[model samples]
Target: MNNLPVQWMAEQSQRGRHLCLILDSTAVPGIHQALLHQLTHEHYRSVYRETAVAALSVGGPFIFSIDSLNPSSLNELLEGQTRDWGWLASIENHSIAILVKHWRERLLIGKRPQQALYRFHDNRVLARALAHLPESAYPEYLGPVISACFWQGEQWATVDNPASGEYPVPDAAQWLATPAPVNQERAILLVNVGQYLLAEHSEDLARLPEALSPRAWLIAQLDLAQRWGWQTPEQLHFLVVERLRETHTPGIKNWEPRPEEHAQAHFERLRGERFPEVKTWR
Candidate 1:
């Protein structure tokens, strides 16, 4: 059994993201059944609903659901036929984003988790996962606010304050709102890069340079387009990559050795360390 997709979905769920894939019943006959068999054999808790949908939980904080859309539901919600695989992936990605947004909102409002597994020490992991999703995957209504909350963190709530200019809250929000095209492969790269950025362990940190190289290349592309006044579909991708890269490592163009040290130190600090007080805030 090729476990790549299942493993990928599991990793995403661990980061508090859920994925739901809807496949055409006629075109992909028995595919869902085979997946169900694999998921069950692997001991993932599977629940089948009456509506031809199945939810799988891998004993994780989040649930990944796969829905084989019935003719009526597919016709009503997705306009009858799935034209592009990227579009289908985008729909599932948007659903995950919405779920993360609601979950984070609940955490911020002091809502205690009813289950032990649901409480995460760092809610930013979940936010980062949502932020890493391609801007194309976000729904028109929930994308902007959610991206603002995720990337800018506390600064998003302070948008009205003049001091909030230090953070790119407005830029992130605008970037999310803009429509763009993103393929599944590029989205996967973004997710991997996000994981490297948020990773707390040394081994994970070691992979940062390679993980972010694609992002650096993308940034260069966007920079060129903007400088030449060339219209491009990759603007949102550029903004997201640049914003995240800068937030983690400032004043560094492209991925290089110097920024790796800064990024490692930043992650180490975030991992909770003690250093002598250097200055007074007054």
Candidate 2:
């Protein structure tokens, strides 16, 4: 079912930039081992290295320099025999290290969804980004990537970089502090992350009132947190705990903390004051 444009990929390989395959290790579990022998350029790296979500980034997204790929290896990727792969991109004159740094800074979207994992390496995200970003942003969005070959709407497609530049990677710390240039596509991706959390923690969802849909509730809570600037992992955990344990704690849905205080501290103080009932973690 994989409509990989083989001929187009071959053409893209020789365009003076290295053609690399970006694989989602979460999707294709042992991607590195699977392509070990066929790796001509061996300059492979996970896009999450040295970032805030490093612990959670295990089996994240991997990018492998693929100036040349063996025929069977290409077949393995396209046969759908394995989990879905990422994208085939032609990157400018930069090594895998350079590319990882380029994508890593973008691992989060807005400032309020602090340190939320961003799968920027995903082809779907790339496709959305192409449509979501302004023409002036193409260079920065496609930084160092000359072109990307991936599945579009219903078939194979390629998105050539509309503009080109060194388009240097930004400092991760600074990027984390500043709101990333707003992109509707990225906002959608962050909400999708919230949905993933809802599904992953479905076991704990039963504690929530039957009238409430955990998915809908969590999205609403995320909006609340964003508005409150309660965006750190600790803050997200505080809100998730409140939802799972007791659906309603004072202002848990929409409380803005003081600028001098953190969400977890505020929630702890509220829990102590209210002394509400709770369920076992199990």
Candidate 3:
């Protein structure tokens, strides 16, 4: 594969608000150098480290790193910190799925797409999405709305024709009042399976319960490592799950509930009523 300029990645962040930088220990040292350079140029402050061990020392509104990520390290690193920070998996392409799974769990947070963003390697698609947002949400949204995968190319193609009914903005009021639209319908649920849940059982890596199965739950435990510029990992995961749910499952109606609307909480209650098993997993 052709090596793309890491400087370009940094420059992309310069044009936006807060930047989430992911540096692979496997990458050329210049990549790290470039990151420092760009961060300085933009006068951006960050939380940073060279290893996941070091990453534990930092806090949010910052950037950090790990020497390499593995299941054990991921479990440990994820458990160490509670302050939300961006995540980067610097492993090879073949292992992307493992990282994706870890990243996948981040979808189970608040009810806004504006909460998080994820990028496999580059921010082309994510940046485009941010550009479409209203100005009021910027800067404040910088950290949560952006994410980066350590290896995406600049020439990344837009996911043209994202499946229809992928992101539906439901009326806020209806979402708060009705539980049926969520429980009665086959909507995908999001669960925060991160430190809050896993910390309870560090010795056991429990498979997320299928409590919401038949219906799906977006899990955000390991996935929120990187807070997209304005979006959170949870929001990004929701988009991905929404697409997958729309494609793989047929005959299921979709619903979007805002946090202010308390749609997710109502649904959580409904989930308990219908699938009491949810209580066990969560």
- Best-matching candidate per TM-score: 2
Model 2, 179-279: lDDT tens digits are 34456534543554554454355556666678877666776777777766666665666666555555443434434466677665666555554445742
Per-residue alpha-carbon lDDT of model 3 for 1-282, expressed as tens digits?
Answer: 212223433343355422233322222343344445544433322322232212321321133233221224233222333212223322222332333233233222244432322221223323343345444433222323233332222232211111211122233312122232332121112322222222232223334343543223333322221222213344344444433334444322433333564534544443354346657344
Reference-based lDDT, residue 23, model 1: 33
- Write down the TM-score of every candidate: 0.19, 0.61, 0.25
**What's the CA error at residue 71 for candidate 3, in Å?**
28
lDDT ranking, high to low: 2, 1, 3
State residue 185's C-alpha deviation in candidate 1, in Å: 4.5
Task: Note the Cα lDDT for every prediction shown.
Answer: 0.32, 0.62, 0.31
For model 3, the superposed segments whose C-alpha errors exceed 4 Å read 1-20, 23-132, 143-196, 203-282
Q: How many pairs collide in each candidate, listed in order?
A: 0, 0, 32
Query: Highest lDDT among the candidates is held by which one?
Result: 2
Q: How accurate is candidate 2 locally (lDDT)?
A: 0.62
Candidate 2, clashing residue pairs? none
Comparing 1 with 3 on lDDT, the higher-scoring candidate is: 1
In TM-score terms, candidate 2 sits at: 0.61
lDDT of 1 by residue, 103-187 (tens): 3332211112211111221233333434554544333223322222111233211111111111222224432333323543344
